[model samples]
Target: MDALMAAFVAAALAQVGDRPAWLAAILADRYRAPGLVIAMAALALLGAGLLAAAAGAVLAPRLTPEAKQLFLALALLFHGGGALFPVKAPERLDRWRIGAAATSLAGLFILAFGDGVQFVVLALAARADLPWLAAAGATLGSLAVIVPAAVLGERGWTALPLVPMRRIIGALFVVAALWLGLDALRLI
Candidate 1:
């Protein structure tokens, strides 16, 4: 479906080299259980993505076309700017009391609460009439980034030039935002 593909691509690209992916890597290493880490991460992503889609479904009907476009553009603009700056993720989480699955679930769910990928999913869903499909796509897209990190482990993560990748994606998002923003204003 159009909504599914759009959401999938947007969320997948938005999450590349992002905090959640890196955090998954950390968790996989710490737990020595990549499968468990991946499962927990998947569950978290699914929950977040569904919630975003639901919110978008509720909100989209209320917003005018221009408003929806503007909101999506703004969300993209904000996320792009943040990605370009590259904030350092929290160095540690207290995992002493939690088991591997619990730690991964809790950490990832909490970390992804308002993350760019989730926002991207929200924005995509907001634009799509089929919001549930968008949510499913977003969840899979998130796994596209997360599953690899869990399977490949630390060396694989280090091999990627994360900062450069983030900047590139950020630049792309900004360009998209500008175009969408302009169109929303009827200037394009």
Candidate 2:
């Protein structure tokens, strides 16, 4: 349960103002199929989470608790920094040649493959022994953010202070990194 909650909160925070939400909004507008877009995106996220969680499970046994703490700290720092300075998403798929749902699944899967949330799930699962729970939680966290973006589009996302929010989240990540690193070193 702790692993589940940790993955959920971490993934949710990592996803804000991120490409998944923007991608959802774009797909919704271009395809006029919010339900399909949201559903496909969620599935894509689930796939990514499961893959990462499995990788994490593989790594967990080889890592000591201190090593896990250090890895988690590094992951937080890396993702937080990425959030604070985001890159533009790929051009929107103006034409859904393969049908809206299929296009959404492919596009989102490709795009979301390397998302911060996936890596966070990897790190969190590596910290704990519950990979499936972590994967499920990460998937839900992504849906929680992306669904609203698909539904509300610009009216919701543009209203938010994205830059400031990213920085704040980034700051939180740095703080966590510091704490974890200190603990790993037995200096805290």
Candidate 3:
């Protein structure tokens, strides 16, 4: 559906040079267990997506369509603008008493909370009234980025042109946000 695809693309673009991808690389490198790291990351993304979608669903019936559109536009604008900045690498959770698996799961889940991708998922879910579908798309999109980063490790991941990708996506999101905001206001 339109909601699913939109969330997928938005999440994928938002994550290009974001903290999650870098965190995935750091976890993979530290554990040398890329599979576990990837799986844990996937679970974390799924959890975050579900929470976002739930919040979106809760707001859908309460807000007018125009209000929802405006909210979505704002979310997109915030995400896009944030994507323009370079993300510093996140610290590894070495202090956790849990083993690597638990640490990864908790760390990734915590990192994903309130992330730009999740905000996009929340907006799309509310706008489309398709909470589960939007969440699924977002989770998959996040995996698409983190899987590669996990497999490649830190050095290989750094080799990718993430900065350029982030800036380009950020600019595109900003443009889309402006257009959508105008439409929501019936200004164009």
Residue 130 of model 3 has an lDDT of: 68
For each candidate in the order shown, give its overall lDDT on alpha carbons: 0.83, 0.83, 0.89
Worst 10 residues of 3 by lDDT: 87-96
TM-score (all chains, Cα) for each model: 0.93, 0.93, 0.96
- Highest-TM-score candidate: 3
Query: Candidate 1 on 81-144: residue-level lDDT in tens?
Result: 8889865864446544678988899888887776877777787788897888888897788889
lDDT of 3 by residue, 39-104 (tens): 999899999999999999998999899998999999999999998888877877767789878988
Q: Candidate 1: misplaced stretches above 4 Å?
A: none
Model 2 per-residue lDDT tens digits across residues 97-117: 898888889888877787777
List the RMSD of every prediction in angstroms: 1.5, 1.5, 1.0
